[model samples]
Target: MVAIELKIGSFKAEYAGKMNLYLSLLDRFERGENENQSIGIILCADKDHLDVEIALQDINKPIGVAEYQLLLSKEELQTLVVNEIKASTKEEG
Candidate 1:
């Protein structure tokens, strides 16, 4: 079984500690003796790549940090990006 954590806030080192605790608990109580090692994923709304790297440096278990996106239509996202670029350009000008 896999353990998944979803967070809408920034990723932090403290989250790794929590993941470790959860994995440990799953292994002890949830996983069967012959089951594959549990997998852990931390899906956050925002994450600093460098911070995530440093946070997972010493972690022995399998853990991954990834970002999630809202299910917006492609055109909507494109429009948002174009508007942002236009705003930025206008401000710069």
Candidate 2:
């Protein structure tokens, strides 16, 4: 299996913990379930690309790193919340 490593950028350690929440994320990027193994590293803030490069000195594996961003508007947030409640109400009905 090709071992894969994931480096995720986060605002804080709390958010970095979400890395575990996506344990299955790399499965799709993989060529096949038996063809690769995945690993992940959560960075609270990576100021430079070089920083991560240095941090992974001895590790030799197929790796990937990405930054996540969120954008929300007041109306969009409210609409989503209302829609969720409506969906639940329908379930109960």
Candidate 3:
């Protein structure tokens, strides 16, 4: 299971706590007996590496923090699509 949380601004320490709660709930109540532990992903518009490190330092569950662009340029989107196609083709080949 994967739980994703999206934020519009910079990452905050509280976000990590919130994700931890979600992960805990999922793991305790929703996860299957044989399923792998749930993973959490927090996506923010901006993040500081140090802040992320500090926030996640003591976390035992699998969680990832990443920055996301609110809007990508047309060219950027096209490039991403092309790259995705190439990746899929390679996988199929």
Model 3 vs. true fold: TM: 0.75
Q: What is the C-alpha lDDT of each candidate?
A: 0.91, 0.49, 0.95
lDDT of 3 by residue, 1-93 (tens): 999999979999999999999999999999999999999999998999999999999999999999988478868979999999999999999
**TM-score, one value per model:** 0.73, 0.35, 0.75
Clash-forming residue pairs, model 1: none
**How well is each residue in 35-85 modelled by candidate 1, as lDDT tens digits?**
988989999978999999999999999999999986887789899999999
Compose the digit string of candidate 2's lDDT tens values, residues 1-93.
Answer: 223233334333333334433444555654474655555544332434565455445445433445544356768878998999999999999
RMSD of each: 12.0, 7.1, 6.9
**Collision pairs in model 3:** none
Q: What's model 2's lDDT at 92?
A: 100
